[model samples]
Target chain A: MEFSYEVKDSYAEVKADGRLNMVSAPKLREFVTDVIAGGSSRIVVNLENTAFMDSSGLGALIGCLKAARQAGGDLRIAAVQPQVKMVLELTSMDRVLNAYASADEAFGND
Target chain B: MTEVLAERSFRGLAEAEAIESVHDELDGLWNDAPFVEAMDQMTFTTAVIESASNIVQHALPAEAQRPVELGVDISVRSTLLQARVSAFYAKPPLGQLEPGTPDEDSESGRGLALIEALVTTVTFERQDGTNIWILSKSPQA
Candidate 1:
């Protein structure tokens, strides 16, 4: 998986493209941590290209969410594909992660 | 005897890379059996990868001389998808096999529960120093 970020006016948009599996989960955590350290706590992880995710990946997202909140901001996901959506719902994390239809809509009202 | 419409097998060192390889095998299997519903393919793939990832992350070597090897055998039949995910040269699992209801903020402990929800049945067996998890899901009509 590859992670890249763009600093929008209110938050950072982190684009993660590829399978979010055990192999790539830790990297995602580290990448998002770096983004937070770079002065953006409000985050939007674009999962449009992330086709698959396992438990480890879910854990990583939860960890990222907590990190964002600790910095007094928030982390939300947008453009979740089918497989990732299934994992989130099955694990009851869809309620926690809070998916939006698109990146622009993630922090639109906030 | 059950006729297998398609099958795929993989054996390798139980580690991070094997997960990707197994996932690739699963993608190819789907290509071979395109008649399986998208939902079935998606759920079964996730369940198999979860079981394999569990072995890579947690399975312990049974002896000093040999490291654990992950072995996966997946087959698609007329109306079913089955996978035998194994950890060779591994000791008996250390913790409970049952799923836990972790706190929402918890980062782990959800794999087993997710697997159970995705598949029709899940069973475990340990024999000859190999621990195997059998997962079967019936494709939707």
Candidate 2:
């Protein structure tokens, strides 16, 4: 998967533009951690183009969330595709990660 | 017996790269058999990848000289989708085979549960020295 980030006013938007599987999970964790360390703890992972994600990918997201919170901020996912959405709901993690319709809306209310 | 309309298989070193190749094969299988509904395709692909990923991540070499090999055989029948995900030259699976209810914050133990939720049935078999996960899902009408 390809990862790119932009620091928005309230959060850093990380765009993951491919399959988030075992191969790319660690890369995502590393990329997000760097973003956190770069002084933007609040993160929004844009999954608009991420077509597939397995358990490994989900684990990375959870790890990233913990890291963001530890840095005194938060993390959210936006524009989840159907397959990713199914995995999230089935694992009952939808309650924790919480999906928004768009990146702009992720930190909009906060 | 249901006749298979289309089939695909891959066998290689049980590593991270194998997961992508298996996924590519699944995508090709879908292209060959377009009659399967979108939901079935999505769910089945997830289950297959989950099973294959488990083998790559957890399966250990049963012997010192040989490493584990991953094998995936997926077939599309009239109304059923089936895949046998195998780990060759591997030891028996460790821990309980049943799915655990992890807390919302936990990340690692959700794979088996997700596989069960995605398919109609999941069965595990260990024959000779290979561990196999058989997953089947009936297409939606």
When only the first chain is scored, the TM-scores of the models are 0.99, 0.99
Tens-digit lDDT track for model 1 on B45-136? 99999999999999999898899999999999987799999999999999999999999999999999999999999999998889999999
Off by over 4 Å in 2: none
TM-score, one value per model: 0.99, 0.98
Which residue pairs in model 1 clash with each other? Answer: none
Tens-digit lDDT track of model 2 for B45-141: 9999999999999999999899999999999998789999999999999868898888888879999999999999999999999999999998897
Model 1 bad stretches (over 4 Å): none
Q: Evaluate candidate 1 and give its CAPRI docking class based on DockQ.
A: high
- Candidate topping DockQ: 1
The DockQ for candidate 2, computed on C-alphas, is 0.93
